[model samples]
Target: MSAADTKAVGPPVPVPPDPQPTGKSSSDDAPRVQKRKRKKGELLPYFLILPAIVAIAAVYLYPLSKTVIMSFQDMGRRELWSGEPAPWVGFEQFTNILGDPEFWWVTFRTIVFMAICVTLTMGIGLLVALLMRKLSTWVRLVLTVALIAAWSMPLMVAASIFRFMADSDYGLINTLIAKVVGEDWLGHNWYLNPVQGFGIITLLVVWGAIPFVVVTLYAALTQVPQELEEAAALDGATAYGIYKFVTWPVIKPVFTMVATLSVIWDFNVFGQIWLLRGNKPEPEYETLGLYSYSKAFESTSFSQGSAIALITVLLLSGVAVYYLRQLMKTGEVE
Candidate 1:
């Protein structure tokens, strides 16, 4: 080879290395991209529910906050009408409510009323639910229709119906009782005595509440495993024993939930009593709801009413917490 040619090829020219990709590989970035998409997916549900949250805050939270504010102040008819601020009295309203003898009496009466109504509603509903399990398809269908019909009836209509049926004159109840017992029940003023008046109210409350209880319990009962029940029976367990051990454990959660809800509902009963009493429930017929209404609207003691209502809310919250704990223990919720 010529010297010049050998000189030209003295060394192979150094070439720059090919550039590597910057940052990360597509595989390495896959998770980050997926993470971004997952985050977006998570946020979608909250966005969907945002409107509901806003609506609920406006409808319920605002009034509740307003009530709490009013409870701290000595708000009355003047302040309510004038839209001016009321004098702040702190806990004086609550103190007054606690000290009042009539308030304690009303509390006692309300507790008793709730106890009686809850007891009857649960007991009768359980019995009805059990009976339904034994009924033929046709009869069960009939009962289901009746219960739904009763449940669907508006509170106002139900109250009116009950009122007419319990009228002092020309009442179907009085006529039936008189015919059966051969006693003069006609023109009997049920409201003359607080006990009798409360009895009627209790009946109305239970009648309205039972259908819901029955339906809920029935649904719970249906979920009980037939295999377990059969196994219990095969082991020579008695009817009551099987129920106590198998059925009860299964239905207990639902029963407790229903009972808790019933307590909340019964504690707040007002419309039926108000309607039955012609919009002026007697002091003897007064419950927590009615008492609050009486204080706020009738007496124009808005702060005191607000305090009473706040107390009721606290009590109900305690009840709700207890129910939630029971559900947790039963594995009904996490």
Candidate 2:
């Protein structure tokens, strides 16, 4: 063989590393895409919900913060009229309210009144809800319409209507009673009689509050499975038995939630008493709500009034916490 041919060609030239991938690859873009997606997901809900957060802050948080700050201060007419900050007094306002015998009595009476009103409201509301469930379509429609009318009436309007109904001489109720029971019962002043006075107020409250509870409970009832109800009937369950065992379990949570709400509402009721009296209500019939209003505006001791309101908030919050604990036990929420 020729010498040149016999000398082996130089080892095959080595290939250069493939030019580092010049264009972006799908894999290289994956992390960026995932991060962008995560950021969007995190921000979208907050953006979507921003208006609701703002509304809550405006309607609830602002007033609550103001009340809390006022409760800790020695606020009065000067602060209210001038919109100036009041002097801080620590817990003195609370201490003063708590130390009063009359305040204790008022608290006790208010509790009793709230309990009665709430019980009546719930009982009537539950009854109406049950009735609504069984009613024929037309009847249910009429009843619903009536309930809506009652529910939508403004608080002041309702108070005025109730006051008209309770007038000693001209009220429709008094007129009817007088007609039925003779001249002796004529002109019996309901507002002056403690039993009748409270009874009237309770009736007014229950009448007004029932519509909401019934509507909520009826909506919950509609969600119940008809198959389970039918199965229960086939098992020879009585109507009441069906309700107690099969229906109640499904609806109890809503019932409990409404009841708690009703308690808070009834406890804080002020319009009924005030409007009924056309001014500050008589102390004998006063609740914490009315008393607070009178103290703040009438007496201009804003701090003491705010203190009462704070106590009411604490009470309701405690109730809410207990309701939440019960809800947790039922696994209604995480």
Candidate 3:
């Protein structure tokens, strides 16, 4: 049994049988493939959104950060060329702006103007919307077309149109007045005094804004249940009562949202005033927007201008804070 026989009779080394395929190999490959696909699926949304994120960062974030940093620093003509960071002045620009009486006056004027413009625009818009609800379909179509045209008109064009309409010699209003009343009122300046000037500007802004208000409010009005008004009316409610209880509440949220937007817009109205006054609107009627522009470009005071802009933004944020908090709490916006 020893060495000679070992080759012939050695305990059979069990040559391991070739493993049978359980078909698990193909299934295992399938799971790996599925995992790869899952990874790809997870990454696809991010890839889709990456371009938007990059675009936003480039357009909004970069400029916003630059403006914010520029506001805090003494950025001027030298920094514009030197390509170096300007000296950081803690609140000096802010102080200069705050200390100026002209800033205070402009701030007050802006608030007043915003209040008046928002009121008139919303009021007139609401009236137009209510009228639209009662109008014949054909008339509604015509009015809607006209409104779309008005709304689509550029701000500069609108301002120019209004300026011509309110012009001293060849103005439509004065010409009509002269034809009806007397030639004495024909050559009168519609924009002579600051009060009159502001009024004219307000008229222009409100005229432009009303179409938007009419469209949004009219849409909201259509959504309001007519049955509620009828029910209230049938229950011996007066017209005023029905409107007060039924119509107002339904449109209140939308009205509020639109008004807020209007205030924000009108408060920062530069193009309207600038173009209306032929680019030299009296300082008395100027808003913070115009003030900032005058400082940054006209006076070459970029830091001060940035400070004023920051202030304006802060002020608007303050106005919107309540609505924003309410929106967040409700998880809804009108």
The best candidate by lDDT is 1
How far off is residue 111 in model 2, in Å? 1.7
For model 3, residues 1-334, the per-residue Cα lDDT tens digits are 5787987786777898998986767767988999999999989989999999999888888767777877888878778787887899988999888998989999998999999999899989999999998899999999999999999999888888899998998899899989888899888896778898888899989988999999999998987899999999889999889889999888887787788889889988888889989989887868999999888888877887888888888998976886676556434543
Model 2 C-alpha lDDT per residue in residues 228-307, reported as the tens digit of each score: 98999999999998899888988888899889888888888887877887775788888898888878888899889989
TM-score each candidate. Answer: 0.86, 0.82, 0.81
Query: How much lDDT does each candidate structure score?
Result: 0.91, 0.86, 0.87
Cα lDDT tens digits for candidate 1, 190-221:
88998988888888889999999999999999
Model 3 bad stretches (over 4 Å): 1-54, 326-334
With a 3 Å backbone cut-off (N, CA, C), the pairs that clash in candidate 1 are: none
Ten-residue region with minimum lDDT total, candidate 1: 325-334
User: Candidate 1, overall lDDT?
Assistant: 0.91
Give the least accurate 10-residue stretch of model 2, judged by summed lDDT: 325-334
